[model samples]
Each structure stands twice: as structure tokens, then as C-alpha cells.
Target: MNQFNKTINRLGTYCTQWDFVKDRFGKDDVLPFTISDMDISTSPEILLALQKRVDHGIFGYTRWNHPDFKNAIISWYQKRFDCPIQDSWIAYTPSVIYGIVKVLSVYNPQKKPICFITPCYDGFMKILSSNDYPTKTVHQSLDNGVYNLDWNELETALSQSKVFLLCNPNNPNGYVWSVEDLTKIIELCKKHKVIIVSDDIHMDFVYKPALFTPIIKVAQKMDYLDNVVIITSSAKTFNLSSLGGAYIICPNITKLAEYVYLLGNKDSLSSAPALFITSLITGYTQSEAWTDELIEYCHQNLIFVKEYLEKHLPTLSVTIPEGTYFAWVDCSKLGIPMSEIQDKLLNIGKVAIMDGDRYEESAPFLRMIIACPRSKVEDGLKRLVKSLL
Candidate 1:
């Protein structure tokens, strides 16, 4: 086990995933695989940077003109994904969800619709719902063990909508869209005049043999640069999500600048720790060997979970994930209603997996976060198997 592998009993130390769930499930103890955050601690380099910022003791307002911050990001993209990104296109925001809301509010469709893929992050639906904006979905196609996009359905939906939201390496299914596939999506969107907001938050966690192809890269090559908007964060990769730093990389310089001037609120200035975390993007570039090791560990953890379920709980099945540490388990075999399954999992199994109802099209599949210590994953699955048995 790597150093980050250990039981998280100190979870009561302000961990919302652990503490907040007690009241929700009416149990003092519940294994929380529900929330998207990992139980694994942040990288030690990230912790040291955060602690340094704390040690400074000022906590003053911060800005993002730092060359190192920008360079780190640039280097990360260039070195890791081989996607060269210009420093000028980066737009700052506290969170991608909030950024999406802001973009929707500004783009403010009157008759045109704002669309989200079904069984998405759920938070995306909530954001649009709270604003009472009409939306549409492109249901995913499940063939045997893999999930894929329904191009005809997607084309149809885009033909009717103005703004389309895309989750690269999708949430529940972990389906990483290929460049060719993303090209099709962009072609459809362009035909319909749909502006694409691509959330690549999970871009950094892609497992090999399933490389992540950013929509920006595809759009640039297709010269549809004006049609795409990329939203990404170090939060997901670095586990500094709570530190609140998100960015939008757009090539429509004139429009993006206009946006900056119009809505350049205090939120645009990323926090010190957030900037620091961005600085640590260099670590990934510099520590490819280390990242390779982590990726190997994650791959092993995924294999362990799949094999355990297949061997011990043959009835339960998980779609072997292509990206992200989340395992989308089809609980339909349990013969339980989606909500009822969630309740039993949390209250009886004492294991908290994300509910399927959130992803409307993929209802009855629990989203299990496997980005934790191997032991925790094993124990959680053991509890899961026992409860189901």
C-alpha cells in the first residue's frame, strides 16, 4: 500500500462526506462512497504547499498574474496530454458548476434550450433546475459491458438546443469521448449553432488504453475554435477541491475578454491556496514516473473490485470503467427500486454509493468512488457484498 492508504477515522475532523451523512441516513456509521471526493489524502507536495501558504499568516487577497502559475498549467498540458494551451485563454472561476451557471445566465437563452446529457453529474441538473431553465439530454447507449453515445439522439437533441454541456470522461459511465467522437459532437453542435461547454474536470485521471482527448484540441484542429468552451480544475486531480479554483479555457479571445470585463467579479481572483495548487501542476509534469505509479495503483484497485464482485458476488456487475476512479455498478439485479437500493446500501450495508436516480437514463446503477486506499475499497466492497447477499 502506498502512504496515502489508511482508514480515515479522523473523518470527523470537518469531513462533510463522513459527518453530514449520519443525519441523512440516520446512522452514526456509514461507509461513504457516495460523495465524489476521494478518501485518499491529498499528495504530500500539495499539503506542504498549502501549509506554507498558511504559515505565511497573512491571508490577504490574491490575484493570478503569476507567471509560475500560468507556466505550470501550460507545462502540464504540453507535457502530460500533449495538448498545447496558450496562457491567454485561461479564465478563472471558483468552481465549474458556478462557472456553468454564470455562462448560462449570461448567454441567457430565451427560446433556445440549455442541454445536459442524462445521468450526468446531477449537480448540473440542480444548477439548471434552480434557475428554472429548460434542458435536454442525449441518452447513453449501453452495449454489453460498455456505454457509448447515441449519435442520432445527440444530433437530434443538438438540433433543438443552443447550449450543450458535455462531461469529458463522463461521470457515471466513465466513457471517455474520442477525438473523432468529439468531432461528431462538435459538428452536430455547430450545425445547430450550439455553444459547447465541455467539463474536463476528470481529464487528469484517465486510465491508459483510454486516453482523454480534450474537445478544445478537437475544435482547434477542426477550426471550430469559436464553438468550444473548456472548463477544468486542478481540484479534481490535486484533491484541493474545497480550496475552490476552476478555469475556463476559451479561444474566442475577443468574446472571452468581453466576458472578463463584464463579469470580472472578485470570484475571478483565485485564492492563494488555489493558485498554489495550480503551481503543483508542475509536479505531474515533473513526476511522470510517480503519476504512472499512481495510475498503476488505481488500475490495480479497479481490477481488484471487479474481480471481487465477479468472484464473490456474481449477481452484481460493474461496468469496467474507462476513466475516473468511480465504478458504475448495475444494481438492477438486486430487484430493488433505485431509491430503495440506495437506502438499503446506506442503512443496511452501511456503505454509501451514489444513487442511480441522479442519472435519469442510467437509473439503478450505483456510483462507487474507488479513489481510496485499497483496504478501504476492499472493506467497503466486502460490506457491499454481504449486504447484497
Candidate 2:
């Protein structure tokens, strides 16, 4: 078996995905495929680096200004995406959402409403609402099992909003944006004078024939770099979320200063922990092979689910994601209400999956995370089949 197929117990680690599912749903026997984090362990190189840091046993105020740290990030982007990024363009934040909220608050001085492509990462909606920021959603249209951006609706929304939050390799449906698609979005945002803040945390998980194009690259190509910002992290790629380190890449130096000033004022945002820095450096510098293997495993899992559904449940539909480890399955044809389908999955099927409504307008769909051991994926599918069929 590959390293990914090994079932590692995460129950006692205070894991939100496994440990809190029972408390959240009041069910102890539920198998959760809800949270976005992977069940697999992180890279061994990162673990070793972290252990070395622990051995030093000195925890104090740290700075992320080291050349090695910045170079690791720069080298990764250059090697993987063929994009040249300057060290000065990079800044640190606690997480991708933190950087986004900061950008939304500081950059939008006029307080124009923000817009995002719908069926997005649910956290974006929560963060926007919590900040009381007005929002407009551009819903993607599904055709032939793929999700396509509605440029007409998007332009209308962009005209009304000052900032557009883009989720490349879109969540729920996981369609990696094409260069052409991104070029169109850049043109639209540039025309409307809207700032583009792209959350590209899943940039590393893209599958073949579906490339992950950084919005900043598009901005640079169009000489509209000042109008764009990118929020990303190794957290999603290497399971380093709890480490709480993310990078905000701003090509425009003036806007970069604003972000630095705003984050500098917050005492909590002083610097990332040394462990996080170590893990990040190791992840970018030494974990490429591990990430490639993980992506292949996830792709196979996606194929497994699609084939299983086609064979056993012909009436149901599953969207094979171009990126990310999620399988968005449509349950509309099951003849059950969305709420009831969610209930049956939890109560009868004993599996916990995210309802489509959480991402956008309510729909008869469920998003299942397949970034776990093959056995677990098989188990979850069997339970889903038993309950729905």
C-alpha cells in the first residue's frame, strides 16, 4: 500500500474534522467527509525539520525576513508555475482568510460591496458576513459535468463591487481556471476598476489538462499588476493549517506597504512561529515529490468515486473535479429534499458530508472530501450507496 493508504488515527489530536463531528451533529458513529483538511500525514521532511526546531527548544519573537524563507517561496513559484515573484512582493499573515479580510478592510476605503464566484469556499461567505461587508455572488453555470464562469453575470457584479474575491480551482465543483478564463476576468475587473483578491490555496492540487493560473501572472501580463493580490499558503498543500502561516503576494509596492502597515499594527500579527516557518520552508523546498504522489492518490480517489457511482447509482450525478480532493455529488434525483438527504446521510448512512447550500444557494448536492485512505473512501461510498439507493 502507498503511504496515503495508511489510516492514521486523528481522533485524539483535537482535530476539527474527526474529533468534533460527533459533538457538532450529536452522533458518535458518523464518518465525516466534510472538512477540507486531508487525513494523510504531512511530509516527512517537514516533520523532521519541525522536530529539529523543537530540539532547539527556544521559542521567542521571530521574524520572517530571512532570505532562505523568501527564496524558498520564490523558487517554488518559479519552478512549479513558471512565474517570477520578487521577495519584496511577499508578506506574511496568519492564514489566507486573515490576509483577505485585512485586504478587504484596508484596501476598500470607499467600502464598495465585495463580490465572489458562488459555490465558493463557505468560509469566504462567513468572513464577509461577519465583517458586515455587502456581497454580490456570481453563480457558475454547470454544463456537461463542468462548471463554467458566467462572464455576463460576473461583469454585472464586478460593475457593482469594488473588490472581486476569486477562488481559482473553485471549491465544491473544482474547475481549474484556464488562462483564457482568467484573462477575461482580468479584463473585466480592470475595466470596472475593481481590485482582484484571489484565494489560491488550492493551486498545488490541480490535475492534468487543467492548469492553475495565478491571477497575479495574468495581472502582470496585462500590466494591471497593481490591481491584483494573491492569498495562498502551504497549509492546504501540506496539512499545515494549525501552523497558521500564509503568504500574501502583492506586486504593487504601494498596496504592499498598506498591508504591511495594517498587519504591523496588530500585535498578534508580529511574526509567524518558528515551527511554521520551518515547516513552510521544508514543504516548499523538499516536499515536491510527496505532493506529486499525494495529488496522484487524490486523483485516483476521485476516479474511484465516479466509477462507483456510475456502476451502483446510475440516477445520481458526480462532478469529477479538475483539482482539489472533493467530489461534488448531485442528489437531486434521489427524490428527497436537500435537508432530508443531509439528514439521511448523517442519521442513516452514518456519513457526514457538506451540503451544497453551505457553499451557495441551496441545491441537492453534497461535497465529499476524498483525501483519505482508500479504505475510508470505500467505506464512505458504501454507506452513501446503502442509504441513498
Candidate 3:
């Protein structure tokens, strides 16, 4: 068995994924597959690094300007994606969402509308809504189980919008954007003079043959890097979301400085914890093998899900994800209401999965997190079969 197959007990760690399911759904026996975080243990190198930090016992204010941290990020990008990132272009933020919020605030001085592909990360819509920023959601059309960008719609939306928030290797559906598609997007954004903020936290989760083209790479290739900013972290790749450290990579030095200036003025912005920075460095530098194994394991889980659904639940269809551990299962064929599906899964099936409508309202889908032990995934599938079949 792979190390990722070992089920670490996360019940009492205040882990919202497992521990809070009972309170949230009023059920003690529910097996939660919601939330993007993994149930697997973190990389051993990360654990050792944290151990060393704890042994020191001095949790003082740490600077984000550490050469080790920046160098690790720089090396990881260059090695993994063949993308070049500079130290000066990087700026730290507490999380990807926080970085995005700062970008919106800094760029949209007139508060012009923001646009993004729909069935996206729900947080993007929520954050924009909370800030009273109007948004144009360009829903991706599904063709033969793969989602593609509607170029005409996107161009139109970009023409009217001030900012375009992109989710490369998009959340929920897990479609890794191709370089060609990304190039077209960059060209369109350039034509419309729209600023691009790409949330690429899922870049590393892509499956084989489906490359994750970072926006910066595409922009650099086109020599139009001035308008793009990338928000990413070790959080998703290493399951370190709780540790709280994400960074923004802005190619334009002047715009990067503006973001730094605005973020500096915010009294509420807190620096990442020492442990988080240590984990980032360890993950970027020494966790490549562990990550590769984890992705392979997840690919097997993806295959298992595709096969199981085809055999046991022939009426339903699943979008075979090119990236990420999520299986976005389409239940529209059943003609059941989304709420009823959620109710049955939570109460009858005793399995916790995210309602698909949360990503796009009225979409007959359920997002299942498959980054757990195979036994656990089998259990969830069995429960799903019992509830819906």
C-alpha cells in the first residue's frame, strides 16, 4: 500500500473536512469527501521541517523575504513546469483568496465588473459578491465530457469587464487549460485591456498528458506579461491549506509594487506563520517524489471511479477529469432535484459530498473528493450506489 493509503485520524484536529461534518449535517456517521484538502498524511520532509521548527521553540516574527523560500519557489517552477519565475516578481499573501481580493481592490479602481469561467471555485463568486463587485460569469460549454471555453462569449465578456479571474486546472470540473487555449485567452485579454488574475493553486494536480500551462508562462511566451498575475501555493499540492501561505506572481514590477503597497497598507493583513513558511520551503524543495506518488494514486482513484460509474450506474455520467482529484458526477439523467440529491447523500447514504449547484446553480452534479485511501473511496462509492441506485 502507498503511504497515502494510510488513514490518519483527523477527527479531533479541528479539521473542518472530517470533524465538522457531524455538526454541519447533524449526523455522526457521515463520511465526508467534501473540501479540497486530503485525508492523507503530508510529505515526510514537511513533517521533519515542522519538527525542527517546533524544537527551536522560538516563534518570532518572521520575514517573507527569506532567500531560501523564494529560491525554492523559483526552482520548483523552473523544474516542474519549465516556467521561469523571478524573486522580485513574487509577493506573499495569507491565502490565494486573499491575494485575489487584494488584486481586485488594487486594479479595479472604478470597480468595473470582473469575469470568470463558470462552474468555477465558489469562493471567487462569494468574495466578489461580498465586496459588491459586479461579475460576468462565462459558463463553459461541455462537449463530449470535456469543458471548453466559449471564445466569443469570453471576448464579449472581456470587452465589458475590467478583470478576468481564471482558474487554471479549474476547480470542481478539473479541466487543465491547454497552452493554445491559454494563449488565446491572453491575446483576448490583451485586446480588451483586461487584467488577468489566475488562481493556479491546482496546477500541480494535473494528470499525465494534460499539461498545466501557467498564465505567466503563456504571457511570457507572448511577451505580454504585463497584465497577468498568478496566485498559487503549496497548500493544495502538499495539503497544507490550514498552514496559510500563498503567493502572487506578477510579471510587471510596477504593478507588483502597487499590490505590495496596497497590501502593506491593510492593517488586517497578517504574515504567514513560521511553520507555514517552513512547510512551503520543504514542500517546494524536497517533496517532489511524494507529490508524484500522490498524483499517481489519485489517477488510479480516478480510473476506479470512471469504471465503477460505468458498470454500476450506467445512467449517470462523470466528467473524466484531466486534473485534480475531484470527480464531477452528472446526475441530471435521474431527474432528481439538487436538494433531494444532497439530502439523500447526507442522510440516507451517510456520505458527505459537495452539491454541484454550489459551483453553478441548478447544475445536476456532485463534486466528490477522491484523494483518500482506496478503501475509503470504495466505501463512498458503495454508499452512493445504495443511496441513488
Best by TM-score: 2
Which pairs clash in model 2?
none
Q: What is the TM-score of each candidate against the true structure?
A: 0.93, 0.97, 0.97
lDDT of 3 by residue, 1-389 (tens): 67878878888899989888876566768999888999888899999999999999999877687788789899999989999989999988888998899888878878899999988889988899999999998888565596766789889999999999999888988988899888889899999999999999998989888888788988988878888999999898889899888998998898888888776665445455898899999988999999999999999998998899889987678867999889888888889898888788877789988887788735688899999899899999988888888
Best by lDDT: 2
- Candidate 2 local lDDT, 1-389, one digit each (tens): 79999999999999989999976567868998978999999999999999989999998988987788899999899888999999999998888998999988777976789999888899998999898889999888565586767789989999999999989888878878889888998899989999999999999989887778888887898988988999999998999888788989998888888888888785458677888899989999999999999999999999999999999987788878888889988777788898778787887889998888888946578889999999999999999988788
Span of 10 residues, lowest total lDDT, candidate 2: 141-150
Off by over 4 Å in 2: none
**How many clashes in each structure?**
1, 0, 0
Find the 10 residues in a row with the least total lDDT in model 1. Answer: 266-275
Q: State how far residue 147 of model 2 sits from its true place (Å).
A: 1.9
| Segments of candidate 1 deviating more than 4 angstroms | 109-111, 266-288
Predicted structure 3, TM vs. truth: 0.97
Model 3 error, position 301 (Å): 0.7
